[model samples]
Target: MTKIFEMPLYPYTRTADQDAAAPVRHTAMIVGAGPVGLAAAIDLAEQGVPVVVLDDNDRVSFGSRAICFAKRQLEILDRLGCGQPMVDKGVVWNLGKVFFGDRRVYDFNLLPEEGHHRPAFINLQQYHLEDRLVARVRDLQRQGAEIELRGGNRVQAVDDLGDRVRLGIDTPEGPYTVETDWLIACDGAGSPIRSMLDLDFVGRVFEDNFLIADVVMEAEFPTERWFWFDPPFNPGQSALLHKQPDGVWRIDLQLGWDIDKEEEKTPERVIPRLRQMLGDEVAFELEWVSIYTFQCRRMERFRHNRVIFAGDSAHQVSPFGARGANSGIQDADNLAWKLGLVIQGRAPEGLLDSYDAERIAAADENILNSTRSTDFITPKSEISRLFRDAVLDLSEHYDFARPLVNSGRLSLPSVYDGSPLNADDALEGGPARTRPGAPCPDAPAGEGYLLDRLGGAFTILTLDAEAPERVSEAGIDAARVALSAGDDPTGALAERYLGAARSAIYLIRPDQHVAGRWPAYDEARIRAAIRRATGQE
Candidate 1:
């Protein structure tokens, strides 16, 4: 059967740069047309910056690699103009159940609150996500966005020329040279560009393997995450299950350190395991199968002058938390706006440093959480195993111990505490969740949502306060979004923005992160905050 991912979405085509007298330099060029690269391209294009994306392959990824997309990622996608389709095709869930052996430990709700438009998580195959991102690029192209996706364009060599990056690309036709003022590498974990630059990852790689299988079947399993520790089917090991868009079910079975990965991936060995997990009567077809070792590592720095790395090229985490692609998308979200500002001369080059600082912090947070989850899932020593088992046992009956059971501290948006771009919190008694350097929590605003109106540029959100229609500081304009408690019948706006203060104002970054907040609309303070957010202060 022919699937969307199997067809050539962006076939190789010759470009004028191949025959140019000199390499044509672009404002921004992204390597690898996967989710992160495509997202960065779309974001830069939307911000009026021209971008070109190059990929070695013309089709989407082969397997259902990353199946979990978090809510914050969905919000970023919404701002990128392709969130609805993803949500429509994804299987949404918030509840997750943890098990010890054959006994159920405890269940959890990731999104316990309301007012947010998206759910806690969505389970969709990576190919489907890439296909949608490609479609979005097409839509942007139709709308005259200066974005290009060149498939079959493999970068052979890279030269970092202080001010620009020179790349030797190998296409189906031949090789060509091109230049870019800025280069964004969104290549996979085993990044060729990283190797070309002689960069290496610094972190730990656990000595444990997990077999991932995407199986298609008609089953009655609920649409929720189910994780089993030391299950009878896979004794002394762990397993995970979740439903996908189609009848496909993603199953992960832990295999200890000493097993032959190739032998375990074979259908002869995999089919019997499936029969044991699901009764012998259940019929299913294997769609994709792979074995992966738990790795938690990242590059020392995401940016090296003109060439920058995003996505897996920057960092990697164990798949249990679904932080890989989600964090990579966040890398795109953080870099695009800063890069656009720098290219347009609206902000200084130092603004790009914030990307390094912010994303590195995010990457470290993910790696830390991922390492802890790996330790909990695959405890190294016998004492560690005993402690983990005792914690799991105690979690079944006690509510307090439930927090100790780490089935992967699920991915969440990183709060950039103490960021250089953040202005001092001036709003007295405001909610901590919406403080400077934190992603804005969505709330009901009129007919739509708060985030839908806050992104794409600097914004001054006035809650029961008066602000100007627009405020410009150092060539950056921040529009005003005025709303009152009456806008949201639920009073969530007031609760989130104005906890104890009667009126408040929030300065929002282009990526929907809060830059500053105040109790009144002071133009001088707003200008200072705008400058700080843009790295001009």
Candidate 2:
């Protein structure tokens, strides 16, 4: 039977730009139609920004490359109009178990709170994700969105002009030239665009490697994440197990530094390891296998003039925390709205700089967490190994030591603390979680969720606070969404948004991050905050 990812969803078709007398210019052009690039393109197009995506291949990625998608990323996808399909086709899980030697040390739940729409994490193959994102692009195009996905269009060279970028592309038909006001690179780790511009990543690469095997098997294991430390199956190393859609299961076995990677990937080498772990009773077949090293690295800056790098092009981290694709999607979420506003002349070009600041900070956080997880999983010396073992042993009984065990800290949304766009926290008694620089937590509103009404534009959310229906500043409109405590039956809105204050108002950015909050609406302060959030101040 034919599979979704096996089909060429976006086959090559020659465009008129190939026959143009000169290079055709586009508002935005994204390289590499992976999850990040497709997401950015969809975001910009939804905001009425014209975008074109170029990719060397026509089909989705092979294998279950990245299986875990976190909750925050699911919310972002909801805003993009494609979250439900992914969640429906994914294995939702929040419970995770950590094992020391042969016994379970501790178990944790990622999302224990209620009133949230999405789960803590979902396990779906990378190919399925790409397939859904491409479906979204088709939906947007049907709705008259100005978005294009050009498969088999590989960029051969990039010339970053001061005001714009010129690209030399190669297609099955032939070679052509084009120009873009802004160029976004979502290419994989070996970013050709990054290389063409003479850039490099800076960080640590661990000496150990891990074998990833996507096994097709029928098993009764519950939907949960399982991590092992120095288990008897693969002694003195780590192992991870995750369930994916269909009958596929993702397994990771830690192989020490000095092993033959090529030989380790063969069935002769991989089957025996799996038999030791799963036992002879369980029937399984290897679907895909690969070996990877732990590397925590990122570019010094994500932005370089008109050429902006995102996703793996800008940063990379160990696969432990599921930070790779999740963070990359966040990069798209951060860049699209700012780039849209800049292109529309509603915000200054400086607003794009905040993308570099916020996402770089996020990348740093992911890298740090990944580095720590790798260190705990594969200790450097005898002292470190002893410390890890001690923590694991104590965690089985003592609650105090459980926090010390790090089986991949797991992915979390980064709070943009000290961001230049943040306004003063005038809501003195407001909840700390919804501070000026924090991403707004989801809560139950009147009928649906609060986040559903918050994105795509600046919003003024009023809770028992009277405010105008709309406020316009410098040609940008900030709409008002008024709700009282009675609107939420669960009191979540009051708890998440207005903790101590009886009445509150919030200014939300297009990307749904909090810009400012106040006890009452003041026109002057709101205008000033709008200016600051848009880089006008």
Candidate 3:
């Protein structure tokens, strides 16, 4: 029998600072300990920045939420030292099948081409993920990462004073006031900080609701995503099936807005629907259940002076794409390096503004894709349904129409094209896959991967070339590595980074995004690009 996993609750201990005569200030304060806030804390602590993380709860998430972990999100988690465990414990699947009215319309594979480090996606319960992250923070704490997690502590007020932000925290022991150079709000969709400031979360709220249930059962279902538009068992609505770790299955049933939300969650009402989809012979135990409405919305900006918003606190999307947690992790990835640099005084505070512009663009992309997926899944009008059916029908035989079929376009990493931080590359003929402003494509580097070798600081990657004798110091931790033909035996690195016998040098940012690349190494250009990437130029 496969055993279910549960995380032990972290104890809420009163800190000396809470018992002090006056409120204690922290260098960085993070609100919430969900995946997003925890990611921020872990990333900052890994960079040796002291972080104080406050969470209103003392236990991991109760449900098997946010099951799909994208490859890019895994990479980000890998940097924080928790990705491998997730991959080890998760159910890895990249194939997805779409069906329409008992007819299989289309199927897709996420990782068609290879040489990447992580799989395209993994299915792990949100609780399990949070548990692993909490354990990782403990490990980092042992390593002298000054990170303090105060569970049962909630933020009641936030004041964005120039140069610093003040937070009024309410703890089980008592209430305390503290100030920080930066305050990152990773509280959920209902962000109290957002509410305190009266910031507008602008976007559309679709009139469709989805019922998600996690069931424990021994079944022969393949470990792949199966999506249905008007399934035969449950007509006029969509259904989704995904295999999660620990013999659990996540089922999503599209319930129109008019349905009674409370009554639908009861097992008496939900079991019959499950029996209709699965046979009565299949015995199962209910694990967790939730009903949620779709909303694709975001704040006007992610950053406000000394206070920054990340994760669901900044934007929200429908669950169809699995963009919420994945994008939230990316938000932490984008912010951590910039915040670390600013805190170290190596980069100007304007570097933090670039994080806002870039992540806001990512949020916009997520919202757009989620909105489109919602529209296709639950058409609002007869004409919309007609077009959706037509597209689904045509997708059965045609490849072009398959792209039109939106049963939730699975999450992918957003590229920061035309970002102010991206330096204009002089070399246009190199590999188009690793273009300027694109996340550095991972390739086989010595024993591990390119991303593992290049993150956490500015790195200059030279292919088929030697480092220039004279390198300029732009006041950032910069390292240079040259890969000779012998070092790259597979030629995969050259193919992904340098194309067609081309030799080049790439300036990779701390976040592992390409700042700029040149056909040949130029010391001055490299320094200038680094300065520009850091917002110093």
Candidate 4:
């Protein structure tokens, strides 16, 4: 079935902040109650913004939507005060093993990162994380902030008139209308939001399809991922094996282009193939199996007008690197605080436009990196397949060849370099090369209060030995400061982060990346940036 959409952009500020009073009397409406929408609503409510969140489903169910949460995603979840609980529930994995034809090809360990003590990655099902987030968001309601969750409510139409977004929702009660200052869509890959906007979701769809099955297996496959190359039963095809919680395992079997989708993917046929692809006597109980034909498309723009797109509504990557929902949540993290700032009369309207600039950069980078991963995983050309086999076959003997043989790429954080909203001197070379305003190094200070204790909105880390009152005088949130050097820049803190990075004040955005850094407190620049980042100026 084909979908058609039409979005109208009424005149609004294109490159400037509008003078306003009382924030134009706004409420926010969010479409889709998934992680991305929930995260966005949670961030907004915490900032004292009134929000109405709608979803077609009323409750949570465990399904395979997203599987991995990178370090960055965890940090954003921490802002909502739920990441620690998530960490407690899921196992942190710093080690990953790659195998080809029953032989180990490559292994990676990620503990050597500058600031983080925990592993860089965690393996938890998406719905489990969603379950945790929903609880955290509810906890905010006790403090007089509320998220009106309209379960079983589907957004049918959106009219983005410049000043307000008019929404038509179909609900169990009946059709209703919602008027909001902004509308955020988190409606997944086949987003009704995107379809209603008439925007092109442009990208190449992969010809090769894969059968994904979540099952319970008696075989004790190690926790690390296993990759098989050209198994005897499925010659010239590969499969992936990874374990999940509750003794379940996720298996991905490559489907040939010519194979009949329904006949070959049935439960009866999948078992024999599983036994052949994964050895006999495995005694694996099949749970759920589905065929996924992936595409590498991205929407032309994240925001068309009053309606803003997030998660699968913004972009869809070939699920090779597990960057889909995780990236979407980050987009919410970035956009929420800015929206709150604008709605609360803290920032100017121009700040909202930056949401488009920053997230588009994020989406573009995700697509490029995920595209590379897709190419590496599904070797399309004959030459690429031969080379992949050669590398895997040779990895055992050659010490230097091990890293080269790995099919996976180290997931690099998307950088916001070219964004006009980024500070001109934010990184400017030297030791701060992880993008202009990347997350600062995490260091442990033993007095029961560490850097980990300072998450929730933008964090201003004061590194000045003197405890300067400059930031406070400039009307910045000084109590929001995490005093890095209380008495002196102690060894405990210095050794954890790079020594030279001490004595610098870091202005971290709500997404936890450094928005700007200064050698000492500069009242004028920081105040301007705070206003800019929050849309206050």
Query: How many collisions per candidate?
Result: 0, 0, 0, 7
What lDDT score goes with residue 89 in model 3? 96
Candidate 4 C-alpha lDDT tens digits along 1-537: 311101111111111111232223348888887889989999998888888777776665345556667777776787687888878876567777676665666666655554354458776766677778777766887777867666667778877788898777676555656668888888888898787777768887878888888777766566665666665666677777767766667888888677778976688889988888767867778766778876788887787767888988888887767778778887898889778877777667677788888888778888777777667677889898787777777876787777655454545556676655545354222255433455554555545434465566555666543434434322336344545544323454544322465466656666666666666666677677665555444
TM-score of predicted structure 1: 0.99
Query: What value of lDDT does candidate 2 attain over all alpha carbons?
Result: 0.94
Ranking by lDDT: 2, 1, 3, 4
Give lDDT: candidate 3, residue 410: 87
Task: Tell me which of candidates 3 and 4 scores higher on TM-score.
Answer: 3
lDDT of 3 at 230: 94
Candidate 2 per-residue lDDT, tens place, 1-537, comes to: 997778999999999999999999999999999999999999999999999999999999988898899999999999999999999999999999999999999999999989998999999999999999999999999999999999999999999889999999999999999999999999999999999999999999999999999999999988999999999999999999999999999999999999999999999999999999999999999989999999999999999999999999999999999999999999999899999999999989999999999999999999999999999999999999999999999999999999999999999888999999999889978999999878888888888998887867899999999999999997689999999988988988898899999999999988888999999999999999999999999
Error of 1 at 181 (Å): 0.6
- Using Cα atoms with residue i matched to residue i, what is each candidate's TM-score against the true structure? 0.99, 0.99, 0.97, 0.87
- Regions more than 4 Å wrong, model 1: none
Flag the better candidate by TM-score, 1 or 3. 1
As a TM-score, model 4 comes out at: 0.87
Residue 119 CA displacement from its true place in model 2, Å = 0.7
